[model samples]
Target: MAKLIMVVEDNDLNRKLFCDVLKAQGFEVKPIADGNEVLSAAREISPDLIIMDIQLPGISGVDLIEAAKKETSLKDIPVLAVTAFAAKGDEEKIREAGAAGYLSKPVSIIPFMNAVKELLPG
Candidate 1:
């Protein structure tokens, strides 16, 4: 079965780009445009991986990742943080929040896929 990936991105172009790329790679992609909708959508979908955007409409992706990590049902799911913040300390903070992998935007196709593959379960 194809792995299900949930992409939480507020930007229309980015969301479409992610979904298109994941789909082409044979993964099932669920694009969530609003941060507020992520948790409930994740619970319902039970996606294998989550591609989270750091700056979001409602809540920060770091906070969302931290929150998801606390939920028993969602804790095990791998989170791949995609952010525009490439500052020296930012990656560490995102990692501390519980992202299994991190990629900066605008992400290159190969590296993005590599990060996704590395985070997905076998």
Candidate 2:
């Protein structure tokens, strides 16, 4: 079966781009704009992987990752943090929050796909 991917991003354009790219790559994608609903949505979808944006309107992505890690059902799924903040220490911060990997925003399709592929089984 095709892997399911959950994209939690607030930006309309970025969300659309991410969904389009993942769909083109033949993965089932669920795109969500609200950070508040991340945990519930993830639980319901049981996604194979998650791509989360750090800066969000309600709960921050970092907090969501930390929460997901504590949930037994969701903890095992890999989460990739995608953020616009590419500052020196941001990667470390995201990792500390329980993200499996980090990707800077305005992400290139090649690297983005590579990151996703790394989390998914071949």
Candidate 3:
């Protein structure tokens, strides 16, 4: 079966772009536009990987990552943080928050695919 991916992004354009890219890569993509719905949506979707955006409306992506890590069922799933704030120390912050990988926006197709590939088992 194709791997399922959850994209938690507040921006419509970014969310759509991520969904389109993942879909093209043959992934079953679930896009969540609201930060408040992330946990419940994740529970329902049970995605293999989560591509999260940092600057969310309600809960920050970093917080969500930490929360996911604490959950028994969701903890095993890798979370790749995709953020526009590629400023100094942002990558480390995401990593400390328990993200498996980090990708800076605007994400190039190749790099984005590569990141996803790394997270998935062969």
Per-residue lDDT of candidate 3, residues 63-85 (tens digit): 99999899988888899999998
Number of the top candidate by lDDT? 1
Segments in model 2 whose C-alpha atoms lie over 4 Å from true places: none
Report the Cα lDDT for candidate 2.
0.93
Candidate 2 structure quality by residue, lDDT tens digits, 55-118: 9996889999999999999999899999998899989989998999899978999999999999
Q: Could you report the Cα RMSD, in angstroms, for every candidate shown?
A: 0.6, 0.9, 0.9
Per-candidate TM equals 0.98, 0.96, 0.95
TM-score of 3: 0.95
List clashing residue pairs in candidate 2.
none
Least well predicted 10-residue stretch by lDDT in candidate 2: 113-122
- By lDDT, the better pick of 1 and 2 is 1
Worst 10 residues of 1 by lDDT: 55-64
Clash count for each candidate, listed in order shown: 0, 0, 0
